[model samples]
Target chain A: MKFAFLILLTASMALAVDKIKLVSTTTDLAWAAQQVAGVHAEVRSLLNGTENPHFVDTVPEFIRLVGEAHIVCLVGMELEIGWMPKVLSRSGNAQVQPGGKGYCEVGSAVTPLEKPTGAIDRSMGDIHPAGNPHFWLSPKALAQASTAIRDALVRVDPQHLADYTKNQQALAKSLEDLHQKNMARLAPALAKLKGPAVIEYHKEFTYFFDAYGIKSFGSIEEKPGIPPSAGRIAEIAVAAQSAGVKLTLAGEYAPSKTLERFSELSGIKAERLATSIQPKGKNKGYIEFQNSLVETVLAALSLN
Target chain B: MLKNRSLLILFSLVCFSQAARPEAAGTGLQISVAGDIVGNFLGTADNRLLPREGEVVLYAPIDQTWDGALNLAAHNEDGEYKFEIHELTIGSSRLIPRSRFKVGQYFLGVGRLNQTHRHDWPFTSAPKVQTQFLYEEGVNDTGAEYSYLWPTPFYLDLTLGITNGWTFGHTHDEGKGPVLPTHYLRLVTYNDLFLDGGLQTGLNYLGRKDSSGNNTSLFGLDLTAKWREAQTLTFLFQSELWYRIYSPAAGDVENTIGFYAYPQYGFSPSWSLGVRVDGYSVLNSKDAGGNNVGSFDYGLVPTFSYKASEFSTIRASYGVKGRLSQGAVSNTEHFLELQAVFILGSHPAHDF
Candidate 1:
């Protein structure tokens, strides 16, 4: 009878554990959620740092994670349109569906850059219908996103609202400190550069560029999400060289061969940096991820 | 009794109106149009260039707990264009906890490929097993399905459904009412093999009893495994096997078995190559005169595809059908086909 009582007590305790299970579609969002939820929740990311957030494959593990989650943080703005909907619909977790108490779209908190004004279609090559979804690269945007996540957590677990609000404020302060430090250091170095500061592989670095007051000549791919032809590549290389572009930047997940060939042809240094926070290894947290990317860009421009 | 019935009707109308109110402001209809144009070669004279199929789908959020969709499909039939209402569904996953419910017409989820639209198929040709056991486009009927995800350590899902059985396969007739409707149950499970790799398997059973007491039952098993990297599918292996038993009211009972296996490799982000082998056999079948009428047919198809972007694809496939009798195999027919599929507007996301 004593042994059975112990077993029942353990089962009840397990059931009573009130840890919110939060699942985010991207690692950066997961990092922000972790900061807001802290010890009161378990945060997991569906996509690691290296995966392309635009075209993730809906794996079974993702479904299981979402199905068990009390809250799901979406980058939204169509960044995960190719896969997240499928996972959400199949997860059968109504609590995390759109408009539910636990459904949070972090991207909705920020006014994104490059919102297309006029008519848009596939001729633009896989353009996001809403706007650029790389707002996490900006500290101000990330702070706003953290607030959204905190609101979602409070809605789901009202008893811990104070904890969430406190954590969110702490995170916002740290993000602001980090942003000011980077801006102070980067402003002088960027002012010393000649002509455009960089050329990017895609528009993923738009927020980063905007945050640092950097000027980007253009993208390697003339049409977003489409591979550049040989002629197109040559044209961009020549134009970048003539325009005195200092560096070309891309996410590490991009094809290395393309970056190298462009660098060789244009005589501009190339740097591929991490765009998402890693689950492990270096650059594990959001702050570290931002710092590493900034350092890489500065080093590529010979200003580090 | 009449007063009670009238009150119940009024209450239902009020409930439906509340449930169907627009969920949010500025929400409008989402429409998607896709088409498949095919060119046939190395075949008979009748096999000329034609548009394979076109589909127009519209979706809207009815309210917080409900959504609706309509799919209109058109295809070329015997040098003429034929159109049909492919699917119309009202679905909700938030009405209940850990469960989803859908009512109206839809493509039956019997196998992996059955639920997927043909334009999204990896290959340009349909496998013999799919065409023989099911229809070329699988089966679509007015039905209601309820899916539940069991709470477990791994991913396990169960779906049960029933559909009107007036006519099976592709038919245009408004047939008489059936004595028994078609009912199906499917169980799905999966395992994570490695990073970015997943293997999913499903088992399905469907049965129907016609007005004439003729009974039909089917069993199916399907598997799909895919390994991918950023925007690149590295490898994929998919297969489906099925068994059918048909017991007529008077004639002899017949059994049919079929299967298809496809393995594909992606050499680059935009290009892929794959081959499919499929075969089906009928056992203990008889003609109208009561003579033995058992037969077997098999097909081999090899295909290649180039994806320009998410919006378009160009695929070429060669298929050859053969028959094995006694101790020799005889080739019966062959065709080389090419298809281009393009999508416009906001297409719905496909399930894994």
Candidate 2:
């Protein structure tokens, strides 16, 4: 009983620590937030790593978490397009609103892919209309997101600025060192590849391809987010055959049917690629996700 | 003048509250209240047979998991009736599985021969046979059912269960209990075909036991080929064969056999048109009611249904019973129905 009292006192003191309560929209942000906040903050990600971030429900439990968060971070290049606006208004937390200091967007500080060049329409199946928000699939993209979060944390609580800086510097150095090693190992294979364009099931690999001086010929999705039309698949089959594009990287969550149809039509083998680290077996986290990308690109080169 | 001033004050209060608490304005709480604001402008003379006709359905789902749900509704037939607690236990794991069980008047697993709600005859008429043996297999029940959804490319859902069999929307006196044995088994399947087409198949079984240990059974099967994005050709064949043995009610019990089949087509996204010809017999109830009611009977039911979206549907169906039609009493008045559907607290949102 006496020991229990001492434990309770310690626990209360720990809970009373100067806390920055954070709610991350996705696992990557949760991971990035931890890099800066360390033990000085409490962090939680609203979405499961396996679920499509765009389709997260406005569950009551989710609302309660958002209500208590001192800060909220999201990959803002329209990744959370359908969810953020509604959740923000419903959160009743002015500190985490769009223009507030607590609202930190990961992508505004980093570049986005396939930004809409014109006005939007709804024929597209749930495209963000702003830009592809899947930029965190690359190491550089992950580092860029951390930098943005660091800047935002600096604004929110200047008292913890030094601590945040030290954390960011340590994280950045380790990330750069790992990225260099992987690049060195992968440089030879990337140079040997003579493919005209890479093919993918979804529009998730543009940043990964761009980092390695590669170009994606087209997406198997006849339209963005829309399942491939029969005629479109037939057309792509012919183009792929002629263009000698042998690499088809299937997104971790893409339908197997689409990949099968593409493979059967094009006579090219397809490779499965992880979009996020999840479900235990697949590579997870920002770093592991980036490293696993080399296999698909290499597979296409090997086929050639 | 007094009313106008009150209205002005109310409207101002609304605006002032919204502005003052903008952050909390759009925050909708988990518990919400919604119902169909129904308007029945067009009515037939037959509808006048009822003193009143309007229903307000109220539902509260346990959560997004759909692990449990309770629904209540007031259908003012005589005055109004309550929709007692309807429970459904949904499972994500394979060992135990998903199920929809209720201890109130509810729908049975048979209508799932066609899972789309709009496909039911006249949109809301859930087969007369279902009502004969059981007042409703479509609303609430005083029984429990266990369902298994097999993890396969072919989406096959299997269900089996036992219930209290009484259908007054709730369980009543023990003496009133028929000790009616209720057992139900059903299966439905779907498979991807070609570039566009798909296949659907279904089967069902139901057995009832009396207090004296007498038992009756019903069985069925259905299949369909969906070729286009919104079109399907379906074929159905069902037989209700019963073993008329072991009843102490000393009345000359007889074995019965019934069969049914049909082919139908869906013409548009919102409209499905079909025709069904079916027949059934009883182990005992002969032509006692009227009109050459042979143990074997059949009917050609041509149906037209429209599902507006995932949430609402309308249907109209008509049929002519032949001479051999079982339960043949008189030419019945058909129906055209409009129904609104809403998945409460938790519904699985399909992701691409």
Candidate 3:
């Protein structure tokens, strides 16, 4: 009887612990939320890391997650404009609805880059009028996002404010340490590649390129979302060849055929890079994913 | 004059109250405009090229929990421009937990295709079954709806709605002071079948009294399965089945059944192919008073589409339709259609 009583007591206590239900639009945001919330939250991402964030489908499972969540963290800046709005509207969760206290837009924590100064339209190639939303690739920007997410947690659960703040600080320190370590190791190579022009398959790598001091030559796609015409491909090939661009990077989710054709035409080495942490592999954590990306870029440039 | 002034003041106060409350103004206010333009070539006995449809949609957030939208559409009707309101709705999801309420003129949630806009359809033409039962433009009614999300481990949603008994192509006693309201119920569930694949299914029921003191009831079921492999390929299969019963004041019930199936495959980022099969039949040949009414119609459509960008697409489709009266030989009709669609401005993403 004593042993049974003890087991029942422990189970009840476990159930009594109120964990905040958290939902994020992307795997990166979900990782950040988990890091900050620690044991006090349950985090789920709508899209797996392997999928492209911009073209996510608003599946019903996403709505169910949002409907039950106490808070929702998103990269924002219209990065999920294609599907997040519909999911939020259909979720019927007032607490996480836009403008709700539980709605946490981590992107707002950082100053965006590549904001257009002119009138915008589809002619601009599916550009985000709010600016570049790929800031998660930058360690400094991610640190800011963590702080924002921590603050949001405090707002929703003040009882655990201290815990959230402490976790957030720890995450920031770790990120800083990782960034410094990578920068130190790549300092010589980065110096050599400074202002060195490179080609990208899409506009997805602008933030990363800017952070590492690499100049973007041109994109394989004629426009942001538009496919490249043969003439356009030929034009870019000539431009890249003349510019001495040695490396071409494409996201893992980009069309492989296009990347292969671009490489054949431009005579530049093409590399596929992960846009997010692989959900179920060696690069599962944010730090590990960043390390792999930096290492890959360095190797592609023949700097390692 | 005094009453009018009082009503205006009341309306202003309501608006001001919503604007002043920070919580109510959630996420701040946003306004966006979107438009769809289509050019179509219709091939029939009289082959003609025409500018099909131009639609402008406006979305505005009144507050955090409340939003308003208006859809203005212009279509070429017999070489003349006809402008009309496609949808106008004010929706709120904050009144109840895991629930939403929408009121105004909008598409009825009877089936999957009824709630979808023409521009978003994968095929170039509307399915024959849908057009026959809900009219050419689809079923739109002035009404209010409340939908709730069930707190289950899986994805389950239930919706209940009430609307004015005004189905398109049917005229009842419109000038009457009041009539029986149409009632609708819908239950939807979703499941993740495998990696990168999902299945969603729904059941629906609708009951209402027509203008002629007749009872009309409809039962429907819908299923959709989708699979996507990154940016390389995607496949979708969807089907809807509907059965309707109409009972006159002094006759036996009349029964009709309709169904449609659509399958689409995207081979690349810019290219897709789709096929649709539609069929409908009136099951009852005689009423209690012994009236002949049985008929059947069927159609097949195949489409190939190319997307230029996120905002533009071109599609070519071929359709074969057959109509069979109770005592006449089946008459077949064939048509070829080509369409170009372009969207501009900020358009919200559609549901999967």
Candidate 4:
């Protein structure tokens, strides 16, 4: 009789568990979430700043994290396309998968860009048919991300509603200030340059580059993700030479020669832009990345 | 060449990685690698191509979610002639109608290395007969598999694969437009070690070939035992025997048996030593001839594996082999090999 009573007490305590501990795929997302939830939730991103956000995997640790979490927030629209299915299925975390109340897609309501128009298939290279899934890079998109995520948190912790609102407001205010500062810093270039241009692989920077008045004329690939051909390179070189464009964008995975050839032909400078920031040693937070992307693009554009 | 190869691999990784589905799987990406080096082929100049090497698949679960996954994987070595999607299976569990089905490109039913992942591999080499009969690595097909597991971890994995029986040449089917043999069935059970053999956990596999007319069969029995904590010893015995009545490549009815036995002791987590003896031959085949060969080998493989951190590992091994079966040895050869595998991102618990 005493053991039975003890078991009932333990089960009650388990049922009352409230804190929703989470592990994100990228450090930037984790840090941003931390800024909002702080002590209300324990958050960790699986990859350091160097890993690719689009391809992070949820192995045992990730599986365990999801199992322990009350709600899972993900960058949806096929961003984490390949691995998310495997991890969620193995994790047995119904709340975190699509269609579940606990499943939180940060950008579900945000309007997207670069969405695939034709029939989707692998022959077309890495295509995100849901449009540019890197919505976090744009401040407006971030605003939308906050709304969707806050709703998710509210569902997870109704009693802690006040706490969630406070953290979210603080994060939103900080973002507003940063957005204003970035716009001001970028105005000089936005006004002075006839047109700032770049060559990109994936259309990842559409929001950031567009917001800052930077123009990307063409991508390295003739089609999305396909390697640039000799003919395409020659054409881009001639066009860049004519437009006085001086900067070329390079993802960490791009071939060195492609960047070099662009420089040799069009006299443009290539800069390595980190598209994803994982949470780890080198990249402590997303703020560092924001300043870096702006400064790098500015410096590259200024050179031309 | 390696640098160039890495760039190409990275390119394909980025390109093919674009495959994404509805967000639901999980958060975080992971990659893992496991391979081997022949004992006699170590400590020599011709070590570029060792026992075998393969791609370490990359997956991001958190961002993509279930139903959605970003798989970027390719062989790191060379693309002279290789398949694009080798380890392309995805983990998925869903209710279709009233039944549950798992869909992915899995090597199920009856191939060594098909169901056994490298990280979970217990032996250094696969069965000799299968390796001898097949030239390509991972003779797997692109297929959708449905597996049903009773409350027991025991499982009945069924697969329906579509492709040319042989994975060779540019034309997979040479205008055959896929083939007649479209599906293979596999049944396996893990109840206990021989119903109750304190010695080990037992698993057996029975796979029906793609066609009903021709049958290719394989049976595997494995055991691993730790005799005493004092010595900390382990013994592994595996035999993969095949009886295939039809194979376009062999052009004959055949029966083949291959076996590998390895016994080792762990001095510590970072160090260990072991001896392996392996051999295979075509016991019965219509085309059996001088080409149908078998060999017996005795070798010593010393390994040093260190976990740099929770996310990474560095393992090095040195092995020496001697030909115990006179002419069975392909050639009196001495070789040296080195491998460096580092995985960063989300990963399963370290079983190395």
Q: Assess each model's interface with DockQ, reporting 2 decimals per model.
A: 0.67, 0.03, 0.71, 0.03
Contacts from the true interface found in each model, as a fraction, amount to 0.64, 0.00, 0.78, 0.04
lDDT of each residue in A1-304, candidate 2, tens digit only: 9999999999988775668888988787788788878876788887656655644433333544665667888988766654565465434455676656788988887777778765564455545655788877666777778887887788777788999999988887867776677667667766665765578877777777766667677787766666677888888877887887868886655667668888898997788665666536546565665666765566556631
Please state what fraction of the native interface contacts candidate 2 reproduces.
0.00
Evaluate candidate 4 and give its CAPRI docking class based on DockQ: incorrect
The CAPRI classification for model 1 reads as: medium
**Candidate 3 at A78: error in angstroms?**
0.7
| A42-69 per-residue lDDT for model 1 (tens digits) | 8988888888788777776788889999
Clashes of each: 0, 15, 2, 43
Give TM-scores of chain A for all candidates: 0.94, 0.88, 0.93, 0.86
Task: TM-score each candidate.
Answer: 0.92, 0.50, 0.89, 0.53
Model 4 residue A88 CA deviation in Å: 1.0
User: Second chain TM-score per prediction?
Assistant: 0.89, 0.58, 0.82, 0.61
Instruction: Please identify which of the two predictions, 3 or 4, would achieve the higher lDDT against the true structure.
Output: 3
| Candidate 3 wrongly placed segments (more than 4 Å) | A2-17, A194-197, B1-46, B76-80, B166-179, B231-233, B286-296, B324-329
- TM-score ranking, high to low: 1, 3, 4, 2
Q: What lDDT would candidate 4 get against the real structure? A: 0.54
Output the number of the TM-score-best candidate.
1
Tell me the tens digit of each residue's lDDT in model 2 across B177-282: 4456566787766554574344556677666656554555555555554443311222222222222232444454545544445455655435677666655555
